[model samples]
Structures are given as structure tokens and as C-alpha cells.
Target chain A: MRLSEEQYELIEAYLNNELSAADRTSFENELQADSELMAEVTLQRDLRLGFRAIGISQALDKARAQYNANRRVEAVPADPSSKPMPVTRPLSTWQYWAAAASVVVVLGVGYFVFQQTTEQPTDLAYNETFVPVDELTKEFPRGLAPNTRQQFLDILKEYEAGNYSTAIDQLKTLPADRQTVHYRNFFLGLSYLANKQPTEAIPLLQKALATPSVALRQKAEWFLALAYVKNGQKEKALPTLKRISADKAHPFNLLAQRVLQKIN
Target chain B: MAIRPLPTFLSDQELYDALKRRDDRAYQYLYAESFPSFRHWMLTHNGSEMDAEDAFQKGMLSFLLNVETGKYQFQASTQVTTVLFEYCKRVWLTELKSARVRTKAAMPDSVDSMDTGNVVEDLERLEVVNTVQKSLSQLKDECRKLIEWFYIEELSLREIAERLGMKETSVKSKRYDCAEKLKGFYAQNAKKMGL
Candidate 1:
């Protein structure tokens, strides 16, 4: 039965216990008399329950995200290490060109020497298994607003089409709300890695790891580890990779174990 | 990054009030304070980290539903986390019991301590909620947004109307239409799944 506005309001008030004592008694009488009204009340009650479930679930998800964000900040520091560096002082005009020439010659010979040497463990391991995950469809939020969802899908299309830079540009334009923040950070991090911007990918991937979805966290962890390896931050990558390797049931566990063995 | 300080303890009423308001910080506080111990307990009880996560999610949904529906009364001296842990622990124990049953093995001693009341019914209710969630995901974008804004988010009709650039009457009508569509989808899925 199509409920009128007054009927809907009355039902809502009754459910919320906003009905006056006399009105509540009358409503209860009507409920007993009319089975249809009782059925409507039941439906309304169930719907409210379902909605509340969704709301709380969403809140829990956001809380998870907050937890993840906290973990990321704690785990990743601005200066991961404090290695001393040689300070460059100002030089004369002739000294600048001469220094540049010498640096170029040294780099040329260094490159040749490095090429002839045995591959570094991280380099070999990363090269053997590191491939950017390009599947963006699954990362799309199922409950985003229509316009935002379409825009995000379009951005995903860009990422899938190998337009990493274009995708990143579009991703930067999207505001990071509660619904989109996790995906935004994760895919954007991957996009940065795809574009060979590992430094840029680090923080985003770290933040993405803080998401409450276990699947998303696994994906972020795997990619984040690879990002560290690509950036030559072996010290930071090893712990994450070890965690993945230890989880025998994780999707990335076998690959992580292989990477661990090769790198070690 | 500034770290949010979590309380070492909170009364049941305080925790329930925070949860009812959907405070993320309160949730973070809850997790920080209790989950580690809960996870440790799970790990010691033949449960993996993944099992702990899954169990926690199930238990949390049940707990939050009860909190929202006023089914969980705040006791004067109860530790909220203790109650939550019991609910979650029971869920894991129940799962283990069922698995053992499936294998025709003897019941484990862990299941012996559980005083079963309405846990099975609660689990079944959560399963229905899960089914509803799936149906909601399958809803058309417009209908989903309409239903979500009006019901889930609890936005006023006038507010939604202004946001959508529609008259309040039209928004109300659309909300009803969307609700009906949602109900149709939910009903079909529930029937198919025997929810």
C-alpha cells in the first residue's frame, strides 16, 4: 500500500517513540486491527535497521582508515635515516664547468663499472617480479556518488590505458573524502610508481596501507614494499615484505616469499 | 603527524554514547585499547591473524547493531571492551564448533564455556544485513544516492532537495520511489539467498 505523508510521519513518530501516550495507544490499536499497517510498520522498522547498519559500517570503515593513517605516520618518517652528506660550496665560473665535466666523466666510468658488476640483490629481485598492477575496476568504490563514481571510473580508464601521468593529474583533482580516500591514495600511489616516481608513491602507498579493508591493505602493502625496493630503500621494504612473506594465506605471500629469498 | 590520545579505560555508558554518535576517534580509541589483547587471545586459541580480523568484523557489526537499536543496555560497572570481546570470542568459538561438526570430530573444550543464547539468531540477522548491503551495492546510482542520502545519512528532505536542486516535494517522491526500488532489490536477493 502507498502510504500517505501523514501515515508515513505517524509511523516514523511511532517508531521513534515520539507519539503521545494516547496517540501511541491508538496507534497500537490500529496496529492490532489492521494487519497491513502492522506489515508496513515491520518494513519500516527493518529498513531503519538496515540503514543504521550501513551507517555504522561506514563509520567503522572510516575509523579503520584513521587507524591506518596513524600507523603510516608512525612507520614512515620524514628522514628514514640520518646519513651525513658532503656539503657543496659555491664555486668560481671555471670551477663549475670543470667540476661538471669531471662529474660527468666519473659517472660515465661508474656506470660502465656498475654494469659489469654483479646485480644488487634488491635490483635483481625487483626486476624479476615488480610489475605495476593496472586493474583499476575493482578498486572503484561501489557506493560513491554518481558523478564522482563516473569521474573516478574515467580516471581508472586513463590509468588502465597506460596514461599514468594523465591519471595522476585527474586523481589529484578529486577531493579525498571518507568514501574515496582509500582508493584515491592507493591507485594514485600505484600510478606514481608506474610513472617511475617512487618517492612520490611512498607516502601515498603508506597512507593507503592504513585502510580498513584487508584486501586493499594487502594490495597496498605489496605495492608499497615494491615501491620502497624501487626507490632503493631496502631497509624500509624488508619489514613489509617479511610480513607479507610470513602470511602464508595472503595472495601476495608466495610472491613475497620468492622476493624475500631472492633479495636475501 | 599528531597522535590522538586514547583512553586506557572508559565506562560502558561513555563508550556506548561515543559509538552512537559514530565518533571515529572513539572507535580508534576502542581498537587501540582492546584489539591487541583480543588479537593475542585469538592467536593463542588456534586463530590466525586473518581469523581474528574476520571475527572482529562480525562481532563488531553485531555489537554496533545492538548499541544502535537500544538492545544493549549500559551496565553501571561493565567494561565495554570486555563485552565486545566476549561477543567476538563466541563468534570464533561458534565457527570452530561448526567446523568440527562438519568434520564429525569431537567438540573442542573452548566451545564448552560459551552459554549460547541468541548468538545464532544474531549471526543470522547480520547475514541478512550483509545481503542487504550487497543489494544496495547493485542499486542504480541515482536510486542508491537518493536512498542513502535520505535514510542512511539521515539528511533532511529539504537539505537533499537543495543539494539536488529539486523541490522538497519532488525529493520526497523520489525518496519513496528509490526506497521501493531498494526494497524490491533487497527482497529478491534475500529470497534467493534464503536470508
Candidate 2:
């Protein structure tokens, strides 16, 4: 008997152990002389058995979260002694971002060590004080800590102080894996523009725009948007700036919003 | 307090409930449970263990932020793992784009011989997915919920029809017709996406 769709379904149910006694007997009779029906039954049964073999959700209780066993003190560093981070970057590229990345790496390594060396206070109740002063946090944007993120900020200081040449040179000595590579590129683009070289600045700024990290991507694009304006290529920069301002959630949206107004 | 054990095959609503209840433990359980397969997927894509770890972290952060910021409105029908994996993978791509750290890591060749059944099989699966989504969009308040309960949550079709005061036969037919519509939709969209 050539199996009809119903007969095929009946046989499938039987082979799947889904049929009752009456249905199974009917399916067996239905399969008589229909070797094709028998073949399908075998194929489906084998495939289902294969699915069960791979197994699913068998290790729920046993698997451990990665951060659990690796214990280190989780406390803010006390007077980190203003040390810089070290970054181990294999140098091959001559891109300005690559140069900036090296400086950022040193600062990151310094932060990592400082974070590691911090003493964990036993008493959480000992202090809950909140005091703010411009002098207290007046460190960064002033001095570039040898192995810290401040090094990039330090370059910014040089740029802000009308010493673009020194800032450009200072960036090269940075470690290879610094977080500030984002800003380094941003500022490099800006500094190059400041020194009357928008063409050299364009690629560096473009790197910032294409940054993968959302915060950095937004920041880079925000500045690239500005850099476009500064280059007198207002047509080119306006669209880019519009993108940053359009992202209402970004921290720089307000800044981008203001800048867009001036350009338009 | 009697703590509800986090369900293994948790329905999306259950996950949303757990999430809404601010149960960190449940989220941790879900992450630990799914990590191995997800890690394997990363490896298959030529991602190092470090890459997997970083990707998972970013995914979790995005998930939590979306939840806390009320961006991820509860979709009662969607699987938590599906949402998590999708979000995680997007973050991974974003990370790869942004990190700019070049690695020689290469992805394995694409699976060439996925056991595609009858030409109708691919179309069938595609249709089911599409019909489900489309009907989901067109359905009224209750019909949508009923279908989700039937398929996604694996509820008995008889129970779904009965609960909604509909004929069981009609429910089955509607479901079939919906699936067929989806299959046709798949046939149409597949061409568009160049699948």
C-alpha cells in the first residue's frame, strides 16, 4: 500500500512511540508491502535518537561563573603614588592611532597594578564621607602619570597649552593597550587640525568615528563631526555631526547638539 | 522565603517575571547554564576563550542595562536564551570592530551540508517562523497569546482552544493555515534576502 499523507503520519506516530495500540496495529497493516513507508519510519526514528544523544542542559549545576574563583581585593587604591601603566604591544603599524594606543597602554598597566595593590578596608562602616573640591581632583588634565590614563590627558594638556608638537611626540611613547587610545586619536585629529594639517588629521579622526565601543564611537564621531567643520568642509562634517546629535542617549549628544547649531 | 528554583526550560514570561522580581540569582543561573554552548559557538566562529568571556560580559551588561532602563519590554513569547544570544553576538561584533586588535584567528568553514529535507522542508520551517511572527502581529489581544502558548510554550492545542472557547478542529486548521501563510512568506522573503 502506497502511504497517503494520513497513513504516513500514522506510521510516523507509531515509529515515534506516539501511537496507541490500535493505531500501531493499523500502521503496521498500513505499511504492509509499502517498503517506502518502512524506510521513512526508520529514517525519522534514527534521526530522533541522534537528537537525544547530543544531550541538552546536562551541566547546569556543575558549571561555575568565571569571576567566582578568581579573588582579588575590590577596593579603591589609596594614594596610588601616581605611577603609569605598562602595555605590551607588538609594533608593526605606523598608524597614528597605533602610536596613540601605545601611550594609552602604559596608563592602563599602571592602573591595573595600582588596582591590584590597593588594600581592602575591613570596615565598610568606617567612612561614608562625600566631599568635593576642584583642587582634590585637579590632577588629571594636568600631569600625565607615567603608566596611567592621565598620560593621554597630559597630552591633551600640552595641546590645550598650544604645544601641539610636544603632544604629538608624547603620544608615541604611550603603551600599546591603553583605554585612552580612543581619546588619543580624537585629540591627535584635533591637534593636527590645530597645527594647520586637516588632511593628516582626517584619517585619525575617522578611526575615532569607526570605534566599536558605543561610548567611544559616539565620542569619536562627535569630534570627527567637529573636525569636519574645522576643515571648512562643512558639507562633509554636517552629516557626521548630525549622527552624533541624533543619538539622544549619548553623553556627547548635548555637545553635538550645540555644535550642530553653529554649523547649520 | 520559599525561593522558586530557576526553571531550565523557562518560558519567556517566567524569565521576565524572574527578571522583574530583581532576582540576580536567576540571571546568574541562566548565564552559567547557557555559557558552555555559547562558548562552543564562539570557538566555532574562531573566537578565543577570552573573546567569549568578553562577549558574554558585554551581552550581560547590555541585557541588564536594557532591562533596568525599561528598554527591553517583556516579550512573553521569545526565549530568554534567544534574546541573550542575539544581544551577545551583536556586542561581540561591535567589540571586534572597535578593539582593532588583529588576530589570526579564523572561523571554521560554513556547514555546507545541513540536512535540508524536501525542498518544502526549508520552506515549511521558514513559513512557520514567518506565519507565527505575522499572525503574532495581526492577532488580537487573546489570539496572539493563545498561539504563543500553543507553540512556543508547548501547550496542548486542545487546552489552548478550550481556554479561548474556540473549536479544537478550527484551532488546528487556523494554526495550519497560519503556518502555510508563513511558508509562502518565507518563499517570498527568502528571495529578497538572497537565501
Candidate 3:
């Protein structure tokens, strides 16, 4: 859409940290190519310099609050951070994994939504989980009496449709039981792992592994080990895999064997 | 090259300039002053605190993007506060609108006050920014240091991770997490300050 004068002016105003993302990015390109527009924008930027700019510093309050001093994932000194650098930095143990989950939540969706540095692992692994969260069932599947098999199918639909954020939120509200619980736990952990936030994923996978059901036990153990690996604890992971691989009949035993080879 | 302070471009006018110059003081001043109000506005309608923060970080990113791309301009004497407020509001509103969560609109009750001489408003906005900066000082040592390192130092993801002894990929994700934590500090303090 050809931007009108006010639209152009509004965009320029926004550029001085005045415009929001929903608006700025949509028109950022158009402003770049227009020179007269560019001059007008520069003038506005100059005048506003003395004025304290606007931004959603609050929205990111989560990031600012808790810290992983031990992990050092966020401890990089800012020197030319404009470029996304390669990182093989160890994903540390998660202490206070609050709600800013978008980073690793979507990793299993297969997009690499965020880039990585070379200091980190060269090969990225994709594993999804599902767990029974009460709140998730309300938004996901309205009824639970439809039989365990069908409930699992419906829950799978939610994961496949990419409603993980919703799934995670809802799962938080649900009790840890019910037949579909395992599935929900599995995928929820997977979503976190996918987003590359294994610290968050580890607990959920640990919970999934805790379930007494043999069906879930092996799978949960497999992911929990992977979660440990992602968090840079190959030592802890080695045992988890070794225990699972001992169960020759377990479905995930084969997967566990492959992982044990890499870490061991 | 008399090392004349590079004339500020229209786009590179806000925190990005100080950020590019690795000026932690200016970044702290700007971040502490503005984050709470943005957080308050973002939390409208039972939205998670993270939603507001995500929008906030995204807004800052867009601001930097515009400045870096050389598309930012200043003409009207609009304070940076108004611009950023408008930006964060628009971004949050778009999210709300897209989610189709109907509620009280985010439009301001009055902006006609802006018609007054721009210079006066600039002073008022600067005052607001200063209030935020003071609030930032209230943050604990780790939080404060982290913020200073990030926006001010402009460190790369890998560099920050390595220095901090964190995984690089984890650091990128954690920056957002830390930002959300900082917002919590701003909100709690704003409540006490009654701002």
C-alpha cells in the first residue's frame, strides 16, 4: 500500500522508537527507498534525540529479572552484537524458567526460528513431548470421556496445528493424570526443547518420565537424557540413557543406544 | 577525520547511538525510565507479563532496525517517550487485535495536549524518562549489570555467552528471559512509587 503523508509522518515518528512492531516492520522497507521521505524522517529523528525514546522495556521484564550467572548464556559483553554470532555455549541448568518461553518452545516445529553460534552443538536435535495439563484440555479438548485413544488424537491435532503456546499455558493448569496426560507432557517438553530452552524442557521431560506407565517411561527417559545433553550435562545424560537402554524391549531403547554412543 | 563526534543521523538518534558507542550509562538511563510504563500498558487485559515484554523488546528492535537502516527521521518535536509509547501500544494492540480479544481500546483519552509547544512536552517526557532511569537503579546487581552489558555494551550473543560462561544459543533466548525479569522489577517498583 502506498503510504499517505500522515502514514509516512506517523512511521517517521515511530522510528524514533515511536512506532510499534505491528506497524513499523510492515512499512519499514517503504520508508528506506523514499529519499524526500528519508530527509523528512532524518529531521524528525534529529529533533527527538534529546527526548527519551519509547519502547516495550516492560514487556521484556522477564528477561531482565532472573539470571543464569552460572550458565553465562546471557553474559556476553555487548561488542558488535548486531550480528547474530555462532554459539556452542552450554545451555545451563534452568533455575527460574518463567514465561518468556517463545525462544525454545517452537524449536521442534523445525524452523530454527533463532540462529545459533558455532561454539554450541553443530547438529541440532528435534524431539517433541506431550503432557496432560488440565488447562490445556479445556482449550484443547473440551471433553475427556471420549476414550484415551481419541483424546490422544485430538491432543496430537493441537500440537500438529502449532498451538504450542496455548498448549503450554493450558497444560500448566491441568492435573498430572488422565490418559492423555502423558502425550501432553511429552509434547510440552518437546516444544520447550524445540525452542532450545532445555532447562525448561528438562523438568517437563523429567515429569513425563516420572509417570508410572511403562508406555511413557521409556520415551520420557529418552527425552530427559536429551534435555540433559542440551543443557551441557553429558554426564547426567549418560546414566539416563544407560538405564533406558538396559530395557531391551523398550521402544525408545534403540534411540537411547544411538544417543549413548554420541555422549559416551 | 578530526574525530568530530559523528553527527547523529535521524535514525541513529535514540538509544542505538549510545548503544553503538557502547555507552552503558545512557542505555541504563533510557531503559530504567521507560520500561515500567510500557510494562503497565502491556499487561492490559490479563495478558501475560511476557506478552508485554516480547512486544517491548520487539519495539526496541524495530526502533534499532529503522535507525540502522537509515530510515529514522525527526521533524515534529515529539519526545522519544511518545514515539516509543505509541510504538509499544501499536504493537500490543496489533497482537490483541490479531488475537481478536475485544476490550477497551488502547487509544489515548487525550493527545490534544500535545498541540502545546513541542519544546515543553520534550521537557515533560525527559522527566518521565528520568523517572524510569531511577527505577532501574533499584534493580539488583545482577539485573542492573546485565542490562548495562546488553543495551549499552552492545555485546554479541556469542561474546556475552562466552564471557558469562553460558551457551551462546541459550544466551540469546535468555536475554528475552532476563528482560522479562527486569520488567517485573519495574512493575513492582512502579507500584511502590505510585507512578
Q: Which numbered prediction scores highest in DockQ against the true structure? A: 1
Supply DockQ values for each candidate.
0.17, 0.04, 0.02
Pick out the ten consecutive residues of candidate 1 chain A with the lowest summed lDDT.
Answer: A105-114
Give candidate 1's whole-model lDDT.
0.64
| Per-residue lDDT of model 2, residues A21-90, tens digit only | 8877887886686777676565434323222211111111111211111111012222345221111121
Candidates sorted by lDDT, best first: 1, 3, 2
TM-score of chain B of each: 0.92, 0.45, 0.41
Whole-model Cα lDDT of every candidate shown, in order: 0.64, 0.44, 0.46
> Could you give candidate 2's per-residue lDDT for residues B47-143 as a string of tens digits?
6444555455445544543553366887767877777786666555543433433444542233223222322232333223322233233444344
In candidate 3, position B151 carries an lDDT of 51
What does candidate 3's lDDT look like per residue over B3-110, in tens digits?
111123244355456543334334434444455677666556444444555455445544533443445554357656566666656555554543443454553433
- Using lDDT as the measure, name the better of candidate 1 and candidate 2: 1
lDDT of 1 by residue, B104-188 (tens): 8988675856665667777777656655655665566577767777777789999999989999999987877776676677777
lDDT of 3: 0.46
Query: For model 1, how does the per-residue alpha-carbon lDDT over A1-264 read when each residue is reduced to its tens digit?
Result: 677767877898998899999999999999999999898788677667777886776565444434433433343334544221111111111110000000101000000000111232111111111121223555666688999988887876565434555778799999999888998999889777654456677899999988888777877887788677655477898998788778887766655665565345
The residue ranges of model 2 lying beyond 4 angstroms of the native Cα positions read: A1-264, B1-144
The CA lDDT at B119 in model 2 is: 23
Backbone collision count in every prediction? Answer: 1, 22, 91
TM-score-based ranking, best first? 1, 3, 2
